[model samples]
Every structure is written in C-alpha cells, then in structure tokens.
Target: MNFKGLFRHFTDMKHYFVVVLVVFAISFYLGWANSDRYSFFLEGQLQGLKSVSQSLSAKGNPQIWYFIFIFLNNAVKSVLIIFLGLFFGVLPLYMLVANGMILGYVLSLQTNESTLSVVLKGILPHGIIEIPVILIACAYGLKVGMLVWKMGGQLFLPVERRTARRELANVFRLSKTLIVAIVALLLLAAIIESTLTYWLVHL
Candidate 1:
C-alpha cells in the first residue's frame, strides 16, 4: 500500500473526520441524558449485545475462535456501514448515531466509577484501535456519498469531463485506501479483543 497516498487522502478529508466526531459527541450526549426516553428503541440493541456476551461466556471458546468471531463480526458491520453510505450517506449516519447512542446508554447505566472503569478496561484495549478504524470507514463512506452526488451532477454536465474524471479518480483511491486501513486495523482489533481485552475483563 502507498502509505504516503493514504496519508495524503486522510489529510485531505479532515472534514469527514470532524463530522464523525461531531455526530458521535452529539449522539453520546443524547444517549446519556435521554436514555430513558429511548429505552424502548435501545432495548433490542442492548439485548442483542447481552445475548452475544452470554453465548460467549457459555461456550468458553478458545482464543483463536474468539479472534475469528470478532474479526468477522466487526468486519461485516464495518463494511456494511461503509457501503451503506451509498444511500446519500444516510445509512452510515444512522449507524453512527445508533452506535453512539448505545454507547452513551451503556455508560449511563453505571452509577459508579468502578463500574465505568471495568467497562472501559474491557473496551479500551481493542476500542483504541477499533473506534478510529470504524470512524475512518465512516468518513470514507460519507465521502463516497458526496462523490456520488458530484458524479450525478457531472452526468448532467458532460462538458465538465475533467472535473468528472478527477472525482472518479478520488473515489477510487479513497475507497482502496479505506479498505486497506480498515482490514488491517480490524484484524489487529480482533486479536486484542479476543486476547488482551478478554483476559482483562475476565480477570
């Protein structure tokens, strides 16, 4: 992979990163303050996560199996979010908000620092890598939507061939770079979650 190119693209797309941060912060505050109001909506999500945890605990799986599971699970979700941005960026936005709200609700459930610490330890080991990777995917996904919109405009103005070509090239390069970074980060995140994170939480 061309590291320099990837770095250039990331720097060029700083606005999207800002978007992710802003959305996450807004939704997190909402989840923290209004969790009770959205309890019905969040119930399913909470239950699903609970069920996954329970199943893992029940099976007592080997580390390798856990790693594989985490990687595939997260990879699927991440890719879906990235591709869903094709929907004029709405789907990706919804997912970002949903995840932030769920996290906020979870954080709100804890009454004390001890509980929060435990949760943070369990998540942070992998989350440090995972969260940024996810956000990057989201940012690139949103970029796809914007490019698509530009391409649409270009369709109506074939005279702007040079501009259209530039947009197309950018879209291709950005997608490739995001895919490489996300895959590598998710793999590392899976390893950490299945090993260091799992042990830390269990201990």
Candidate 2:
C-alpha cells in the first residue's frame, strides 16, 4: 500500500532514526559499562521478565506460547509508542533507552559461554530484524512528537500552521504502512526467537 510513499517518508525522517539509534547506543554502552553498579536494579527487571517467561511456559506448548507472547508484547508496545509519542516524544525515547539498557545489561552478565557466542546464537538471529523494526517505530513516533511540537509553535502563524497540518496528515497516512511493516517483521522475529534462537541457545 503506497510503498513508494512510505519509503520517501522514511527517507525524509532519516535524521530522527539516527537520533534514536544514537540514544539507544549511548544507553546500551552505559548499561554495559555500569553493569556492576546497576546490578540490583537490572536483576529485578530480569526477574520480572523471567517470571513472565516461566508463566508462559507453564501454559504448555512453550514455543507457541513464547511466540504469541513475544509477538503481542512487541506489537502492542510498538503501536502504543507511536501514538503516545504525541507527548513530545518522551515516552518513545524513554522506551528506547530502557530497552537498550536492559539488553546491554543482560549481555554484560558473566556466563559459562562467551558473549560473542551468545549474541551470535541467541540475539543475532531475530535481533537483526526486530531491532531495526523497533528503531524505525521509535523514529516514526519521534516524528509525530516533533510535528506536534511544530504545530504548537505554528499556531500563531496561519501559513506555517497550514503547512504543519498538511505534513502531519501525510505522516499519519504513511504511518499506516510503517505500522504494518513493523507488525509483520516483529511477528517473523518472534517466530525465529521462539524456535531457531531458542534451539541454538539451548544447544
């Protein structure tokens, strides 16, 4: 559905995507470097995630359950952040930072196996797609936030107001395509994570 339009829209917002990537990278680095200092906090978060995983596993057909859980979890959050980004992009940015930090912290933890091996087997498989989808979603969300900010500033200028409104409408139109892409890719990633990544990690 209007694939060319979606591509152009994304190209226009490339800077926003770059901003999201930079923020996540910095947060991840901080999490990794300060893992020891933030151990207790990160541990609590991991425990909550562990509990959710255990509960899902208990429902039987663990792989199916995991796939459903992961898909729905990511889909809902990714979509929600897009709209919630109306709040000056604060929520989406915070989400990026939090997720990046959590991933980094988890990876920083010592294990019987090497970190590279863990990443190659457990994360790279699904993350290669999933991470970029998440980042793109956040970029769109950030764009929404910035547009809202611009709309506010243009309120007194009738000409600028019209321009901003038109741009915002275009964003909403293109966003439908982006959301569909994100959901579909995340679904595939969930399947890979639940089956391929799980198998490789266990091996």
Candidate 3:
C-alpha cells in the first residue's frame, strides 16, 4: 500500500545481488557478443511459421496471441529465476551464467550492424522493465533462503519447545507480494516484446 514499505521490502532482500549480476552479465555478454546467432534464432522461428502456413491465421492480426505467448515467455523466465534462487550458491551462478551464454549465442543470428540498433530495436524496449523486475524477485528469493539459514531454520519462533504457537505470517505475505510484482513486470515486458516488437518488425 505504501512506497516506503515496498522499498523496504525490496532493499531488505539485497542478498541476491551477486546472483543477479552474474546472470545479467552472462545474458548480456551472450546476447551482445553474437547478435547473428540471436537473429538466427528468430529466423528459425520464422521458418517454422513459414512451414506451418497451412492456415490463414498467421497473416491475421497477431494481437490475438499476445497474452498467450507473453504468458508462456514470462512463465519460462520466472522458472529460470526461481531455479536460480534454489541453487543460490556456486551452482546457481553457473546455471544462470550458462543461460546468459546460451541466450547470447542464440540471439547472435540477428544481423544488425550497429550494436545500438540491436539493443534498441531488439532488446531494450521491454528489457527496460522486465529484466530488473526479474532480478528483484530472484534477489528476494535468495534473501529469504539466506534469512532462513541464518536463523537456524526458525524464521518464525523461538527454538525452545516451551513457546505458544505464534504466527509468522509476515514472511509469507512479503514473499507473495514480491513474487506477484515480479510476475507483473515480466509479463509486461513479454507483452511489449511480443506485441509491439512483433508488429514493428513485421512492418
């Protein structure tokens, strides 16, 4: 409800900064290093569409598939984010960095002579909001895990056995709120990337 509360929640969960950096760096390097491969990935998808030209729907208003496609993309990204959080130590970084590499290598197919054009025309539009949101959510997840670990697996009550059954409802609430916000941003990016970009590119 309040901006301060939201900021507090976000800042309180900064433990995942390392993981976020690693993932972003890898993704950026791969995407920017070989834009050709990225183009190829898109071309391949086009080729698939070309093959499936049996229906006239492909030529129709793509606005119809907007939500469906973006939902799926955001879902996949969310999975990656959550997966990274689960393995937050060296393993998570390895996996996250690998993802960046793969993305970079794949997106390299797009043949844009100018680096700025590639970023501006291809990624920066939606990535502006989505990427940060993803990182924020992942950071929260990492923070929660770290907090749980630091508290000796007792995030909510005294370790002693003689205590009343108290509630630790706050932790769950914060997690849910953070997760929902992240998802909103991700879907926002996906929708923009899919709908607007798709429209502009096909022009």
* Residue lDDT tens for model 3, 1-203: 34456667556445467667766686768665755666565455456545543342465655556555556656565545543544433343444454465546545545644655666766677868866665665555455444444554454655563121121234455555555666677777878877776666556
Give the C-alpha miss distance for residue 142 in model 3, angstroms.
Answer: 2.5
What candidate 1 gets wrong by more than 4 Å, as runs, is: 60-63, 112-116, 161-165
What is the lDDT for 98 in model 1?
89
**lDDT of residue 176 for candidate 1:** 63
**Could you give the candidate ranking by lDDT, starting with the highest?**
2, 1, 3
TM-score of each predicted structure versus truth: 0.88, 0.95, 0.63
Predicted structure 1: lDDT: 0.80
Better of 1 and 2 by TM-score: 2
Which pairs, if any, clash in model 1? Answer: none
Candidate 3's TM-score reads: 0.63
Better of 1 and 2 by lDDT: 2
RMSD vs true structure, all candidates: 2.2, 1.4, 6.1
Query: Cα lDDT of all candidates, in order?
Result: 0.80, 0.88, 0.56
lDDT, candidate 3, equals 0.56
Pairwise TM-score winner, candidates 2 and 3? 2
